[model samples]
Target: MNLHLLLADDDIDDCDFFKEAIDEIGQLTLSILNDGVELMNFLLAEPANRPNLIFLDLNMPKKSGMECMEEIKSINKLKDIPIIIYSTSLDRTVVNHLYEMGAHHYIQKPGEFSNIKKVVEKAISLFTSTNSQLRSKEQFIIYP
Candidate 1:
């Protein structure tokens, strides 16, 4: 099955890297939003356009990832879509808070190109699994 993914981030380099990784992964469709406002707009624009999974960056201008997460969770139509926090920050408190707020997974953006590909592949596999199992906090963070 082809998985549809959306990534919201402000960093141009990170966005480019993610696109490159996804290109290497193959059989996936990706749409990107540069910041939280654009992310929210895309998500709220049409229910039919919503991606199967979302990769969100925590730090953004106009709106933060945390703020977007809260809004997404509150909206019934968008609530069930899986969200993966893709950020450079590894703060334990923030990670814990995000878990509680209903993010499906968290990934500390890997520096290496190969590592980025690995993590993205793993996240896609995990999200597409049929089991629908709830992962522990330790398991939530995907490492390259």
Candidate 2:
């Protein structure tokens, strides 16, 4: 089966980059949303169409990814869907809190397009191979 993934980020360029990478990877379907509210609504509105995994950006207008994470975990129907925190900042404090909040994986957005493809490919591979199991804290931050 093709893997269905969701990427929620405000940056249009990032969304396009992610799409291109995903397209190159093949055998995967991705849906991109600009903000947290739209992401939540998309998930809630289509229970059956929800993506298998989520790539969430921490910084967003209207509602932050952190808040969205909290809400997702709180909702029974949405709680089990794996979330990978895809953000630019690698702040240790926030990373620790993300782990505490139950993010399945963490990815620091790469500067290079090649790195983005590499990082995303690895993230998807790990998620599929491990059956969406949460990794150890040391292994949480995925780099290209």
Candidate 3:
């Protein structure tokens, strides 16, 4: 089964860049959500379309990453799926708060395209390995 990823960020270019990076490194499908509400709705309402992982961005207009992370973790059904916070800022306080709130990982957005490419590759590697470990232990594919 192919890996699937969901990106929850308001920036269309970032989403596009991420998708391109994913295509560069591995075989993965991607979906983009422009806001927290959209992200939550996609996960909650469309159970059939849930992705293996979600990449959330902080400081959005309406619903923020913190709020979305809280909501996602609180839900019994959605809590199992990993959520990573991807933001431009490197504020330690925000990172710690997100970690406390139950984000799987925190990745600071890169300014340079080369850096973004490297980061994206590493992100996919980590995410895939973690999920693979889980599935291997369970003797079943976790994300498809």
For TM-score, the strongest prediction is: 2
Q: Tens digit of lDDT per residue, candidate 2, span 1-144?
A: 599999999999999999999999999989999999999999999888899999999999999999999999999999999999999999999999999998988999999999999999988888888867556777788989
Model 1: per-residue Cα lDDT over 17-136, one tens digit each:
999999999999999998889998999998888999999999999999999999999999899888999999999999999999999899999999999999999999888884434656
Q: List the residue pairs that clash in candidate 1.
A: none
Question: For model 3, what is the error of residue 111's alpha carbon versus the real structure, in angstroms, after optimal superposition?
Answer: 1.0
Q: Model 3, 1-144: lDDT tens per residue?
A: 477889999988888888787777667888988998888888998787998888889977689988988898899999888776788786878777776676767778876667777866666666766552232212211121
Residue 71 of model 2, lDDT score: 98
Residue 141, candidate 2: Cα error in Å is 0.6
lDDT of 1: 0.92
Instruction: Name the lDDT of candidate 2.
Output: 0.93
lDDT to native, each model: 0.92, 0.93, 0.75
Instruction: Count clashing residue pairs in model 1.
Output: 0
Q: In candidate 3, where is summed lDDT lowest over 10 consecutive residues?
A: 135-144
Most lDDT-accurate candidate: 2
lDDT of 3 at 99: 68
Looking at candidate 1, the ten consecutive residues that score lowest on lDDT are: 130-139
